[model samples]
Target: MSESDSPDDIGTSPDSLDLSPREPSARQRRQRRPWLAMIVLLLVVAAGGVVLTKFLTSAIDYYCNVDEIGAKEGCEAGRRLRIQGIVDVGSVTDNATATEFSMSFGGVSLPVVYEGEPGGIFKECIPVVVHGILRDGVFNGDRIEVKHSNEYEAENPDRIVGETDKGSECSQ
Candidate 1:
């Protein structure tokens, strides 16, 4: 044992002693930050997926003509849809509880059982749009829109109908 060596410095040499405070390197800083960043990124992605699914579901618009629906297999049971057709004359039967009718298009007929009142202009041979679902081969309708053609005009000089307040025009 050397006389100059003390018991307090038994195994450590002067070259091996590190007494300064350590500063973290760039790699260590990066490692500590990723866990928080990853959690935040995952939450953002999940929220985006939910919003996208909701938008797509609400934006869906499914509609078809009576003939097309009858001829194709795309209309699944219990799926809501819109059907465009001409109301058959004498086919409407309005009861105390419901209105049952038949519509025709391209020789295809669709039986509709509506639980609501038909529109004011609804009648034989009128173009209509029915909103409903097909159950047991019949349309269970909730709403009906009657489409009227513009046949009455304001400019016919020969007007053969009842007189209006014309204010001037009935003669050429």
Candidate 2:
């Protein structure tokens, strides 16, 4: 209650007053501004690398025809494939464990063994795409995509076998 002590100076002390602004720590710097952008960019690059690896490893599958099995570059054994061929008449045999069949194209037959039943218009004398890997001489297939009547006629309307076309390397 002294007269020299004003209301403003009553509660203030020199030891307690610190008005200088201090630099932020390294942790604080990482949580704001350019560091944030760098962090985001790093994450984006990591994700892109993962996607590219997945695409190169499995997504880029090889497609070929029945006659191109051993001759094609990507149609070798121990790799994934999409082989297209016509289902030979009376070659489909569905036992309890699998469906075994032979597909013919370029007058060559490729034996396929699928582990499951195919759906959506699959039958004899039709073109199909078999997805799987070739082990030895047999194709260990997992899926069958029948190029049904409508799709076949629409896509290959003029695919005629004539004297000029490669006459059956398979046929003697």
Candidate 3:
């Protein structure tokens, strides 16, 4: 094809000859790239937000002694934490709805009101772990787990009989 060739020599339809405004293929792809990237980025960000929300919303299991309720960090009121203590002698009171009890640890007493009846040897002078939130000076417990795994009791099997006979010396 030389410059001398006329436009009539080349085949051209009436529609092709018309100067209609239409984007090129490369321009279309380029225009679509930003929207594609934005969708992918938005998906990634949304997935990240979901993961962060699950991590933040999940219950944090931080076990603390009853004495550390106000003394230790992350062991204050309004936060969910696990408190372990020996149930005070003659402290448990169970009604139709809930159970109220006081436990002692390191000379500090924490009064707890469990929403349900505790099972598995939940008795006076027994070490128990309660999971709940501390609100308005009292622990609002929803679950109770008696700490039955004691190293001393495990090692001194013979002393268990005498100890049970004498009962716990965990004074209030």
Q: Of the candidates shown, which would achieve the greatest TM-score relative to the real structure? A: 3
Q: List TM-scores for all candidates, in order.
A: 0.50, 0.52, 0.54
Q: In terms of TM-score, how similar is model 2 to the real structure? A: 0.52
Across 17-123, the per-residue lDDT of candidate 3 in tens digits comes to: 44576556987878879888999999999999998887775445436898887788877768888899999877889999999999989889999999888989898
Q: Per-candidate RMSD vs. true structure?
A: 12.8, 9.3, 9.2
Residue lDDT tens for model 1, 53-80? 9778643544578888845565455678
List the candidate 1 regions with Cα displacement exceeding 4 Å.
Answer: 1-62, 70-77, 153-172
What do the candidate models score in CA lDDT, each in turn?
Answer: 0.77, 0.79, 0.81
Clashes of 1: 0
By the lDDT metric, which is better: model 2 or model 3? 3
RMSD of 1: 12.8
Error of 1 at 133 (Å): 0.4
Error of 3 at 72 (Å): 1.4
Provide the global lDDT of candidate 1 against the true structure.
0.77
